[model samples]
Target: MPSFSGNEVTNEQIDELRDAFERYDLDSNGTLSAHEVRLALISVGYEITEAELYDLIHSVALYDLIHSVAVRDEDRLDLKKFIRMMAPRMVHVDSDQSLLRTFNMIDRDRDGYVTVQDVRAIMVVLGEVVTDDDIKDICQAVDMDGDGRISLRDFIGFMHSPI
Candidate 1:
């Protein structure tokens, strides 16, 4: 099971990356600089050390990757290229199926449905702290039937959607 979030990047993930880039690229420069990336990560509760931040900037090819091929003069980190470069690091697993398996494992009751309790249990396993309201909100979002529980199919479908 992949322990990291944003792994198993899909088209939706790419779209999300593009949206995030657009939101973070306040200047509409079509690129994200090291400082900009740092700010974005910080907003998401991620704290990178100075050395790690530098390494991440270089590893993502941010300095060399350009926003547009036609505009060769503008050397900046474009969202698409940044996504491609960082996709590997975002995911700890190699496939979406693995993530699904993890989700299944968390639905331990095998009742074909997951409730707030289920989410709480799962979060505990992942060493994450989640409030009951958070679990409830998640269930509400995924449980289209309004049954107060998320069916396996629905959960899987939600996971397939953008996070």
Candidate 2:
């Protein structure tokens, strides 16, 4: 877990942020410019407007200054910095109905559980160029019981897990 401003963030959130960062690091440069960051957040279903993005980053920059942490470089953010910036924002999506909606979207088969196949299919349909291993890793991250399938209970727990 990582802590920022006295707030702890879980490993699962960090992992998801890392994945988004990697996906949107279009140049494979291990960093995301503001434009890339916007795309990444939108990909993950965060409908942030440009104004909101600017405001969030400005606040994050102030936090960085106070904490002596360099979260950006020439308008680009690396994986670690991106995780630190996103973890708190991610926590607000933990409402039960929102989580249920997200779970249902991923559980394409409507089988009461989310499996690798469902995730992979969704990625494909979304035109995301993710590898098979990436899909497996995503599923494994939320499969709290190591069962390779995520039930609604597991989904809720993952969404609301204490940082």
Candidate 3:
């Protein structure tokens, strides 16, 4: 699963989130109502009911509640609040099995490590024009242990890291 930490939220990630928020802010009011939030989540592949959304907000401690009440149509989330709520959930969206599948695909030789050659070959197969330098740069970024290759652990960490 993705392993993003609270402190690891990057500018690029926040920018992407801002873009999403703008997309769902239909009224252009700089906020999302419950319905808009629901649509945004659904667009991002989360299937949530209204009650589930409210429950999740409370359980996740997304906001400071002065008092408790039933869900209301006026309930809304500003960009900052939405980001607070989404960051934690984003880390848990991918399961271990899904990560494994992606790792396996990247580890083309089944050697339990992803070398630059493997990544380059995959990129070529996918019709991506990447130079050897590009591959090296990617490997350098992903190889946490500095061993010139990405083990499953490194791959997982790379997947988990905020862009």
**Winner by lDDT:** 2
lDDT of 1 by residue, 1-163 (tens): 2222345765554554555566567587888866566544432234566578677766545434543234343324677656755566545433345445645665788777777888788556544576878878867988867878887667556545543
Q: Which 10 residues in a row give candidate 1 its minimum summed lDDT?
A: 66-75
Give the Å shift of residue 93 in candidate 3. 6.4
Candidate 1 residue spans exceeding 4 A from truth: 1-13, 16-82, 85-99, 161-163
List per-prediction Cα lDDT, in the order shown.
0.59, 0.73, 0.67
Clashes of 3: 0
The estimated TM-scores of all candidates read 0.44, 0.53, 0.44
Task: Supply the global lDDT for candidate 2.
Answer: 0.73
Give the Cα error of residue 111 in candidate 2, in Å: 19
Model 3 deviation from the true structure expressed as Cα RMSD, one decimal place: 11.5
Candidate 2 lDDT score at position 134: 89
Best by TM-score: 2
On lDDT, who's better, 1 or 2? 2
**Model 2 misplaced regions, further than 4 Å:** 70-74, 92-163
Clashes of each: 1, 0, 0
